[model samples]
Target chain A: MTLLERDPKSPLTWSGNLPVTSRYTFGLAGEKFFRAIKDEGKIIGSYCKKCDHTYVPASQFCEKCLAEVSDWVDVGTIGELHTFTVLYEGYDGARLVQPEIVAFISLGDGGLIHRLGEINLDEIYFGMPLEAVFLPEGQRQGSILDIRYFKPAG
Target chain B: MTMRKVAVIGAGMTKFVRRAQETPKELSWLATRMALESCELTLDDIEAVCMGTAPDSFDGIHMKGEYLSDGAGAWRKPYMRSYVGGGTGVFVPIQGWYHVASGMFDVVLVVAEEKMSNFYPHAQAAFLTIFDHTTERPLGPNLLWIFALEMNRYMTTYGISKEDIARVSVQHKRNAANHPCALLGDPDITVEDVLNSEVLAYPVQRYDVSPVSDGAVAIVLAAEHVAKRLTDKPVWVEGVGWNLDTAHWTNRDLVYPRYVEYAARMAYDMAGIKEPKKEIHIAEPYDPFDYKALHHLEGLQLAERGQAPQLYIDGTAARDGNMPVCPSGGLLGVGNPIAAAGLMKIAELFWQLRGEAGDRQVPGQPRRGIAQAWGDLMQVGTVVIMGR
Candidate 1:
């Protein structure tokens, strides 16, 4: 039956009019990017001389300064926690049995905001220091999940 | 030094909801019909059409302007679409101002709509895409994170508290209680209640943010000559201004909207409004989030920064207050349908100035009012000042 012919009161729904798109990634390039962090325990950033801005989660262009970033900077593993929240409600398809703390951590030059791992909620505070922990090389996916969140600074 | 006047002769809208069962085209058609009917004009009477939607991705329809032509009654008509995220709703009307001010079209129809529910699983994830796609999105930050960061800075720098900011939400939503189309109006709530609400980010709670709604709104503008002939009491669009800021949102301080201030100053200069706080009777300063109302209040120079929340506590920003803000319940209560929400603010100002707002009318006679919308990662400011 045609979409309009179906009963409007029925619970069944379709995405006929709505549009959808998927993402694509290169095999070797994606692998190398992920494997570096997993095996070497290093953090990567892209630097642009035209804009003079460094970005985490690395990028090809300096959006504001509008210059291409050809140089890579090694971000120090330790940083300070600017602010954080322990989310009680499930979000974006991930349901956690226990709530998770997503934090905004400030590096020396810039900062990276990400989820925290293996940390007690009560132990966290504003301005607290933390460090990144890379995933084991064998289990690396070459994606953002490389560091798997940061840990408390000693 | 010069004057350019435009008038809104037509209006249209769609039934607002949490999720639209109709397609994007159908939604546009619904609002377009209502706006045309209000103006006592048919689609044929419209000289041109200007469309506004928050983001191409929110509706999951890229190049949505072309797809929505049939519903907006733009078939074979000059059509254009522009967006400024949350600011698109108000920007649509500003675009209409140009259409008439430049003498390009005598009658221009402005339409704004959004169907946020289409981004299923999580609309907040849609916000993840709004950040630096590669730099910020990988962090899995939600939309509220940016607001939270800004709110935190506002609070820390100005010494504002959660309760102080919460008062604006309480007052605005309470004012919305009388609004005809208010979606989340509640009078019984107190500042304590807002403070107690779940902390999504450090300072932004659920109540602090505008609800995700599915709806559409439209308004028709006519040049002075045609507008004077169409209606005996046409609200004059005395001035309009829109400006965009750098996308480097992180570099700037979010305590106040600098771009909004620049845009408002430009409009006020054109409208000959030397004193907005005293001359303007009514206002709708984009309240997509409750704190935003206060932020924009300061940005528009309605009140001094860090003083807006105190104004709310003093009942000065209420419906019958000295200078009422968001009398139509705003996005918090009235429902935010993206682009449509800003147009709705313009319509509300139109109704108030014409003395046509039945139930949501302010206490005394109001001569002039201003409506402003901010969007595009808080980069764009669209301001319109209207007078009777």
Candidate 2:
């Protein structure tokens, strides 16, 4: 290995790129979550009454009781602030113009992680409440982003 | 499977560093050489070898095991690589323990190495695939997001204050000061310092996280009879167990690590330990994040659910406390090179059990010890039980 200061000869690095793309089918469980939000304009979850547990975005199987969650329940859009973080950096190693407020919004009996829209950094605490502000049904697609972001609850 | 008894005769490691000029093979060779030197053994004495490493993406190589084999002293010898994320470190010994204990090999060498700094831009950029590619990836998730979410859930469920959790950093970093091999061993680190550090994610701060590092650690293991001949102070591998939860982490309760509990129970049962809190004299739980240490402590049954924070706050989890945690400064104080950090904990335990730890030695003889690591997508839990 030659010094870069002189004439570079180190063979330590190889630069190349691999293009990868694929489509995934979310199967029976995931399709329900997407369809519920897309067609019905509502959030749905798999509620295991035996364990009294409901999962956000739905799961095919119950982890705690090892039972199939066939029963579906419509959960409220309003939820509590489970926990959150203000990310100073992005995944690409760049500083963001807006320090993204990432949070786990407690929805249904279970919860989902989403971006917090309205933020007063000083006032944000662990248990602060929040509500999901959805995009108009016309603009909404069968995707999690269709919910736009969660805002501070009234 | 019934396993024959196995013992650790020696351990060696390269100093944890943010970056290393040495290549991955060179780093592995260095640690392997040091391990052999410590035991006064040659490569010829080894029967087989097992290597532990994280992802190929971090090392910027495909077939990471094949590339790392020679450096691990597996040239023309029986060799294999076992990886289960960060758990790969302790899992190395667990795999090697099986080699010797099963009477398949009289001696086995276990090594773990990671060159996280080798990744371009940032080492974390390579972790993108760990998330659900279609669903979660679309949301722009970083690895820290899972930790923050879990920490948020844990803190909220237990009413645990960030200040109370910050004490793990204080305790571990201070203990790391005594460790010569430690990378960030600053005795002056305080809870105030941790709390005041940059917030990477909610409830997670810069000081609360372990630094990314490049390092390697190796250990020489032998069956009971050979081990007795190799070293008079053989640290016996009493038990080993590992478990992985569902990859879909959102489905599970983040407050309790049932997977870690299951893994610990398996190891403790095999080790004949009914009450780990009373029996485990020292613990070196993985602390990639400071909160993880406390989280794993509760999982290991060293502390009850929601009680680990109080233990740290009450000074009950300090080095001189009734049962010490992370006496080797852990990943928080020592640099975390992923797999290497896990093996470093085992090395520390070997030294502690044999009373060979210089400044980092625990007061009173530490006879029984446990080292655990968690990995995967907020899933896997790996545990090892060892004794003098």
For each candidate, what TM-score against the reference? 0.85, 0.89
DockQ of each: 0.20, 0.34
Task: Spell out the clash pairs found in candidate 1.
Answer: A34-A142, B11-B35, B12-B34, B12-B35, B13-B31, B183-B333
**Prediction 2 TM-score vs. true:** 0.89
Supply candidate 1's per-residue lDDT for B325.
87
> Per-residue lDDT tens digits of candidate 1, residues B37-124?
8879888888999998877677887788887878887889898998788888888888878888887889988888888777765566
- Cα-based lDDT for every prediction: 0.77, 0.86
- The C-alpha stretches of model 2 lying farther than 4 A from their native spots are A1-23, A46-55, A60-80, A92-94, A107-109, A119-130, A137-141, A152-154
Identify the leading candidate in terms of DockQ. 2
Q: Ten residues in a row with the worst lDDT in model 2 chain B? A: B129-138
Best by lDDT: 2
State the lDDT of candidate 2 residue by residue for B1-388, as single tens digits.
6778999999999988777778888899999999999999999999999999998888888899999999999999999999999888988899998889889999888999999877765777778767765456678887887888888888878889999889999999999999887889998888899998867766778788898888999999998889888888999999789998976576567889999999999999899999998999999999999889989999999998989987787777888888889989999888999999999999999999999999988989989999999897878999999999
lDDT of 2 by residue, A1-154 (tens): 1011221543455565445668878777889987877777777889898998887778888888889999888887777877777777666556567788887777776677788887787777766888887888888778888778888888
